[model samples]
Target: MTADISTPSRALDTDSTLPADAAAPASVTFADLGLPATILRAVTDLGFTIPSAIQEKAIPALVSGRDITGVAQTGTGKTAAFGLPMLAALDPSLRRVQALVLTPTRELAMQVAEAIETFAAHVDGLQVVAVYGGSPYQPQQRALRAGAQVVVGTPGRVMDHLERGSLVLDDIRYLVLDEADEMLRMGFAEDVEKIFGQAPTKRQVALFSATMPPQIRRVAAQHLNDPVEIAVTRQSSTVTSVRQTYAVVPFRHKTGALARILATSDADAAIVFTRTRGAAEEVGSALVERGVSAATISGDVAQKDREKIVERLRSGALDVLVATDVAARGLDVDRIGLVVNFDLPGEPEAYVHRIGRTGRAGRTGEAMSFVTPQERGRLRSIERTIRATLEEVEIPSPADVSAHKVRSLLTQVAARQEAGRLSMYQGLVREYVTEHGIDPIELAAALAALAVGDDGPRAREEQERFEAEREQARAARRTADVRGPRREGDRPERSRGVRRDAAGTRYRLSVGHTHGAQPGGIVGALTNEAGLNGSDVGKIDIFPSFSLVDILAPLDADAMDRISRARVAGKPLRIKLDEGAPVSRARTARPTGDRPRGAHGPAGRHDERRTERREWAPRDGAERKPRHRTA
Candidate 1:
């Protein structure tokens, strides 16, 4: 059957509108933002090409010495928005706490402090300290005395510092409230107010929030003076490449349900969001028990320890992260392929922020929330607020888990075979067969039985039970289908089709014969980096300069992000969709004279030179050559 496979649209339609002036790019560069040359150099070294919308709008206003209120969504480069300008304005020579940034929780405080340190790396004699509860105050007090010009901390610790005279904000020139709404939600409003009162009146203040509730607006009105109000609307809030869904699982079975879901779903790395610190710990431990490499992040973790966990996650050493709302703020891991809500967030806004972690930049991501039976109403409320309906998925069965395990075992066996180490095992088996005078088939069957473990019968029984359950689910789905299609009046409608399928869209990748790419190489990379399997991947057509591959739609944003960051053949794959016209137009625009010849190019010219080179090259290297050269 000829499928109607086309490239999917990349635009995200949102109700949020951008300011008319924002359409024009800001003329300012890192140097123009009053940042010292050292800091600007540092930013360049970190691979940032241009300031994001929030940074462009908030930076200059902040540098002009005005109290500012910035309303921007998560992942809009808010850290650099405040960090770069603040660090540039700092007088490193003055050791007495010149700047104080208050975050809602310890995780955010640590994140802010890390960003400050990163931006201030080239600046000599700059001291940045992060203070929060759950740790000894003596070390923090010592750091303050030893001279920290920039202080990033939670409100409670800042208050404690003020009371103990360990941190003197009387000399503070710049005060920033990062994620002010979160602080208020965490009941740190009174502490924040007290901290504001402690600071000098001449200080410049900056309040950045995702959403400005009435209370946040009132606080901004009271604290900021004729503040330059910069609101970055939801135009940027539409993360285009992310495909979001939710699963309705009871609260008691949430942990088991999450495990089952992960077992069946294709995800490279996943982040499980919980409501509390304790929940993060409990869930993380449970995932580890189930053989998943998982870790937890919360307020209780030390700064050094949190950094270690985050680093491991980025490096793929950890596949799952369980974190609370406060613990996960400012986390930007490109490899996160999925975001799962083990427990529904208390607030609707928190739900948005939780899922926002996965789909970032221009990559596709998947967000799944686990809703309890009682919490279905709350889930509906969240759906109404976001103006999006979530699709429900069934929990995976034991058979699914067994299939995954068996596939993994086979893969390991294949790898061992390729490594040419099976000779030892072959000899051992041959000796056993000859000594026992047993039939080769019987011997092989005995070996296979041993490999599958002594409890193989029990495993088969479990698989049978799981298959029975799957049959039941299929019957139920058929019943639903027979009931008739959902009508518009059905309040919230269900999402049709499989979650694994990318909805029948094609994407283009910058890797092909030119990059030593094989079908297996592409499959491995997609599976390892995006958590997709070989079955989900469609047709792969390799061209000289690039390749086009059919991906199941809608693509997962987190998975795409991981693919973007992944390296194949020691080169970064700059992949995107062809969308037909763009590729055709570019190809048409190219002059025939400029086009390089493939393996089947004209003879007697450099074609022979290319052919000779290909003949001398290794098989892998030859595969990287153009088709004309290969011929």
Candidate 2:
């Protein structure tokens, strides 16, 4: 199991200095890499004109069937660096798993699977399947049984299938350990080692990690053959063309701040990055409610729908796209003039990737991040990672939004006056002024106020509320500064005094008592998948063939999409808003003395008399619970 791979056969440091005459070619296309026409065509179709630093170096070695250890940060196109070459070398005609890629999280597993699927689109019979925890096993098992040529999954899930005899690595010719350091950090080292042992001894291996810790080095030396080592410099320099800045905004007001920021921004289009899919849905819906043209894309979005959404952004039909990191990976659009971090990313590397979405093709772009009072340390970390201090900027105020709108309106008015197309409008205005015996200038002013939507009392009230909140936030910071260094628990809770007592909307789920669906299971699914908090769930009534659940109102499309895809009792919960009248239980009614037909005696209440409690057994057959991180 061990090899003398401490010193690799070849070392390629992309950041190393080279003589002017010996430098890498200015541009190297996929075709120049000697890939098959099928892969080349697919890459070209995806609009990839040149390989990234990692891709330029690693693809050739990978294509040569050499094991590689790549040291690169996120957002360096590592997926393509490994995926393109892997696709080129895979045996499409084979009907078993020839390539096995292990990721640290389900989000990454799905992302890598989708990227590889895009690369293998033209390679006939090259089926790719992604298996991960927190999902049912039936579908993934069926995918494996149906002869998937490539398998991508989290280590624990993959190990589970291997133990169940559903996934055999006997034919695995290519083994990839992506984000190896993350895997080790997430406690997947043992599972990874078992998988490595089970795979074919004579196989090409690629181990990519942002940092080469001692543990990762040990794993690489023990498991990999004499491999080529590749290192890509951090992406701080990649985003030099991007003007990075941040705003200190409270979490509750982020949506309003984002709407105002977008309204005032001159960028043609923007992408807002959130830390989770649920945040994406919430932020996007809030933007739309604020009259901003916005859409959302997350892991829940279907591939075709995602493609259409991206196309809309490119075509300038959509101005704002709210997305999670994995969902927006490898997204390219020339018109993305701005990037907004709706929530600060957990890692600086992720911040780099999120901002890199813009400032492509030598074009200048702007990246703005929202920082809460507690997130100052994270902001500093990003600054250190980027090797630059981000400019602290103010969130656009309501006045700023009004001024921008007024400027736009005045510009239109001037254009119309210059074109001499406002004669009818002028006549109508004059007639109105004459009938009311009002000053013409005052009438014009009133019309302008109406045009900019600045005349209403509601608008004035909202503006005052916004200013008051901002002032309170400033006062809190000042008090914190004067008092100095309080314990975390000493900090006061931030609340808007909102109540959750209102009855939320009702939705029907396809799982019920007959399907062994319990109230606990339904609550878990809603909180875990749709990002609903326990308090957001209102009522649960389980019928024989279906269930009615009440969740907080204003469920956005993205949340609904996630809920629809969620599985309970090993079945898809085709959730939809309950539009029909309540289901009548008259036929199933029993005598007053008998037990009720539903899971409980009444709606919104669980059976308190039932004392039996069921616990989950570890599915991976390990002594500890399976570890996973999607958010």
The top-ranked prediction according to TM-score is 2
Question: Highest lDDT, which number?
Answer: 2
Computed on alpha carbons, the lDDT of every model, listed in order, comes to 0.64, 0.72
lDDT (tens digit, per residue) of candidate 2 on 438-470: 998887777777877887687789788988898
lDDT of 1 by residue, 327-356 (tens): 565466777779898877644545666676
TM-score to native of every candidate shown: 0.50, 0.63
Q: What is the lDDT of candidate 2?
A: 0.72
Candidate 2: count of backbone clashes, pairs at least 3 residues apart or interchain: 0
Clashing pairs in 2: none
- Candidate 1 lDDT at 181 equals 78
Give per-residue lDDT, candidate 2, residue 371.
88
